[model samples]
Target: MTDIPLEHVHVAPEDGSDGEPAPAVFVLHGRGADEEDLLPVAAELPDDRHVVSLRAPDPLQGGYTWYELDLSAGGLESSQPDAADFRRSLDLIVESVEAAVDAYELDADRIGLLGFSQGAITSLSLLLEDPDRYAWVVALHGYLPESHADLDPDGIEGKPVFVGAGAGDRVIPDSRTSAAVERLEAVEAAVTHGSFPGGHGIGPQELEAVVEFVESQAR
Candidate 1:
């Protein structure tokens, strides 16, 4: 995969409550979704933090895709080029997060990641790949990659992880979600799992839980 330059959309919190540099939340959107879709939700988060919603690099049939897929090829197989692209994009994200941490003068230990659907999967992958990089991870309607069996358990030990999924989620099966939880637990992650009554999406209760999770980590 080519090392394409990275670009992002950033939203800073409104002024006046705390003098502390705001902790940042990096958001990733679902397949076929753009950076704009997740920014408003980031704004709704507690006002004490900075939020950045990133755009995927690979261009799909008119829109952007974090990776490539072939349905006929079966079972979540990402192209080599796409996987390489994702790795490069992830590296860029880490750099950006570090820069934001320094620029905002925020608590480095408080930085977090929040992702939806495909973004959520990416967040889980990144956290499992490099444990100490993020203080907390919030994944909504997403499951861990099947390839995670190869990851070293020590990488995610003691990391705080929050996962929310709908009992009726058609996109992500309950079995997959359960397996993800099991894998995370096996790795000694501090995991909190939530299940809502709806389908394949976030609801108010899930949002509240996420806010609480992040706030708790910030403190």
Candidate 2:
């Protein structure tokens, strides 16, 4: 267990246009990556929107991980099982996002969560834990939380969700991908799922689908 302060960075559109309320996206990177890892992906999104790429709270040897995984405790891969710690970190992230939204006068209903790998897992967890926090969620190369059984889909209220996974992803098995879809559907989320030909990564097709989903939600 190591203690490291969470870090974050933001990337705004290059154009000098400003507005009373600017739509924004909260971008989370995969495990072993920092806020900078997702900066490039933000550029691929619609430039008219504001993008904030956040770093994980805990620092790893060369990167960062949102929570610790305990394979030693049976088959459980818990995410910072310490409830208080998890909530504290999650609160920090959420607070940062809300502050940014307020500063930009962005419509809360237009904000979305976009994450890859572990970040995707976190995005799903956050959406399920607090449905009204985000209007849309985009998860890439990740599976649903193991504790999906405890979630209340009715809380989601038909929020739009986009899930993209590789057909042959070894890290996140196809079965897990299917399970994730089922869970989202059960929660009454308006889901759009896409499968690519690669493994544990995002491709041009996947990115295109994500862009389309975000644009639709933004409108």
**Model 2 TM-score on a 0 to 1 scale:** 0.85
CA-lDDT, candidates in order = 0.74, 0.75
For residue 155, model 2's alpha carbon misses the true position, in angstroms, by 4.6
Instruction: Rate residue 148 of model 2 by lDDT.
Output: 43
Off by over 4 Å in 1: 1-5, 15-20, 70-82, 103-105, 153-155
Q: What lDDT tens digits, residue by residue, belong to model 1 across residues 1-219?
A: 113134577677776336766667888887778778777668777877777777787676665767654344445432122456566767776776776666656667767899988788888888988888788898888777655545775558788999888888887766567777888888889999988888877778878888788768744
C-alpha RMSD of candidate 2? 3.9
Residues 155-181 of candidate 2 have per-residue lDDT tens digits of 586889999889878776656666788
